[model samples]
Target: MKFAATVRAAALCTAVALLPATTAGYAQVEARVSPEFARLFATYQRIKTSYVDQVDDEALIRGAIDGMLASLDPHSSYLDGTALQRLNTMIDGNYQGLGISVQMEDGAVKVISPFRGSPAEQAGVAAGDYITHIDGRLIYGLEIDQAVEQMRGPAGSAIELTIFRPGRDNSFDVTVTRGVIELEPVTSELIDGNIGHIMVNEFSADVGSDVRNALRDLQGQATGRLTGLVLDLRRNPGGSLDEAVALSDLFLSDGQIVSQRGRNRQDTIVYESETVYRGDVAEGLPIIVLIDEGSASASEIVAGALQDHHRALVMGERSFGKGSVQTLLPLTRDSALKLTTARYYTPSGRSVQEGGIEPDIRVPQLSDPDAERRQRLAMRESDLRGHLVNEAGVQDEALERDRLDDPRFQLTAAQLEEQGVTDFQLDYAVRTLRRTAGTVASR
Candidate 1:
């Protein structure tokens, strides 16, 4: 009862805060509490008193909050204490677990993508694999947070996972040993022909600075001056927005990077280049940005900025369309609302809500044998239920434009492997850079 009263009071406060200062606004706010509050309270009371089992007040309240957020969008949700801690752990980039991002789809936990060089990846947990159980216990209907909690443990711990991979005949189990996951956001190396390959794992803290350092290190390692650079953003689910801006600024000297517009005009903000960093760190070097269906949010932001500014040539398949920005609004110390506040835009004012960023050069991951199958089944923002509609009304045909196979990408995974090409996308980018070294830099 105490918690219910607290919830009511919080709702009232939120309503009052959203209302204008006029008396008419106050009347409208008061009127909003009439039938809606009664219906919600009635349902809560019914569930608490007449349910088959004794339902606690916290459970009822949390369920209500979760249901409310579920109605908004897939990204907007309530973060409980455990969820908050997990988010913090991701931001800190150090955790002991199977480093894979998973989402609940139709009561089944589906793997998004395993982090690079994580135990899950080392143990061969591919994306689109549905985790059916944890340690022999069925977890088909468990909450995503609960399922993730069951997976996390101290370093050197082992956990068994039952995976149901799509396109496979039967389910299989794999044992992954947990270790300390130190996420190195920016990792660079000098490839053949003095080309710098920098793979940004995520847009975590100090990503810009880390990238600058990586570029310097790459330049130092290169036999001669660096001819070109490939910024690989494949399978990066995005992180800090500020870091995205900073990373984009490293390649652009002038012009707007990205803009975000919300319901209120006051919430509109524009980010520009040369604000975070002075000038293009890798100035006059051909830059190719590689993106795929796994790249979303901050990754899209950086890709969009560089593409719009003609600083980098965006290659690979279309990106994961996630243009909305989620703002964390704290209600309590351990609880918060991750609300979708604004829809971001590229410098050219293109919103990648439903229609993601189309690559300048469409390159498929030919090294992955299941690339075509996964592309057909990949879920983006538009696939989610209750996702916000794009204002520009993106055509459905644009989403399927890549389905038609190109003659250039005819090589099979086995063929690529036989040719000693592990990553087809990166190799293609490297070859492109080698051939067109001064071309993208002149863009």
Candidate 2:
């Protein structure tokens, strides 16, 4: 009831603020109570008084709150209890589970992506898989928290999942052995030709520091000067905003990294380089940033900044396009409103709302046989119902083209695997870097 009252008050305040300053507009706003508000209150009263089954006050309030946020956008939501705890755990960068990021879609659990090097990924679980059942129990219509809880267990425990892949003709079951999902936010290795490879799993706390350390480690492994650097952000659903800015700052000497704009003037803010770390860490080294459909939010921020600055060549598929900033407004001791406070922009003022970061080089993952089919079924921010519109006004044709198959990519996952290519994208990036190094050496 208290939550409903707060919602009503907030709605009223928003309506009043939108009213024109003219006397007629003021009179019209004050004279008639909002019909929508009245209808909502009436419905609430009817449900409370005349429902056949008794409904708890907390359930009613929470439902009301969820409905309100759901109407705003896909990313906005009500967070409390397990959901809140999970968010904290993600930012902390460790959990005991299958290490997959998921969301509820139409009452079914949808896999966003499995964490890099996790058991789920090793078992071939992929993005765009719909999880229908957990173990032997039907999990449809269950809360996301409940479904997530079912997936989590002690390390080494096994869980069976019934996955409905959009491209597949029939559903299949996958058994994964859970483990201590210790998220190594940044990892680096020296590849052939002294190329440095760094993979950023997530932008958690101290991610900038972790990346810096990774760079140092890779440099140590190299026999001579590092010829190039590959910064991998594939399957990285973003985390801390500050860490994004911090990581971007590592590649830029100066200029704006990213900017956030909200309805209120006070909410607009710009983040610049040279504010976190100093000059570019890999200065003068050809840098390639690898991203895909799973790379989102903070990942986009880093990629967008580096791409816009011409500091890095962004390769792979388009990013996940989650540019909206969610400010956690505390409601109670354990609960908060994960409200969409602002939309972020790249240095060139491009909004990443629906149109995600387009790669400088559109390299398809030739390794996966299902890549083409999955791309067609993959859900981006643009596919989400009630998603925010880009202020620049995007053409529907552009969004449609993203799913169209390119004749250039024809290799199957099995074919590539047989050729000793575990990851086509990374291999392509390394080859590209090697070629670039050759050109520089010849010059």
Local distance difference test, per candidate?
0.84, 0.82
lDDT of 1 by residue, 1-443 (tens): 00001133366347525744333553465577575655666576577678999977667767877898888887787886889888888888999999998777767898867888899999989766789999999998888899999999998989999998766668999999999999888888899899999999888889999999999999999997999999999888888888999999998999999998988898788998889999888888999999998788899999999998888999998988889888766666787777787899999999999888889889999998988777776777787778889999999899988667889999999999999999999999999899987665533
Candidate 1 residues lying further than 4 Å off, grouped into runs, are 1-32, 441-443
| Candidate 2 deviant stretches above 4 angstroms | 1-36, 404-408, 438-443
Q: How many Å off is the CA of 59 in candidate 2?
A: 1.8
lDDT of 1 at 183: 86
Q: Clash pairs of candidate 2? A: 367-413
User: What's every prediction's RMSD, in angstroms?
Assistant: 5.5, 6.1
lDDT of 2 by residue, 237-331 (tens): 88778889989998889999999898888868899999999998878888999999998888999999999998889999988888788776665
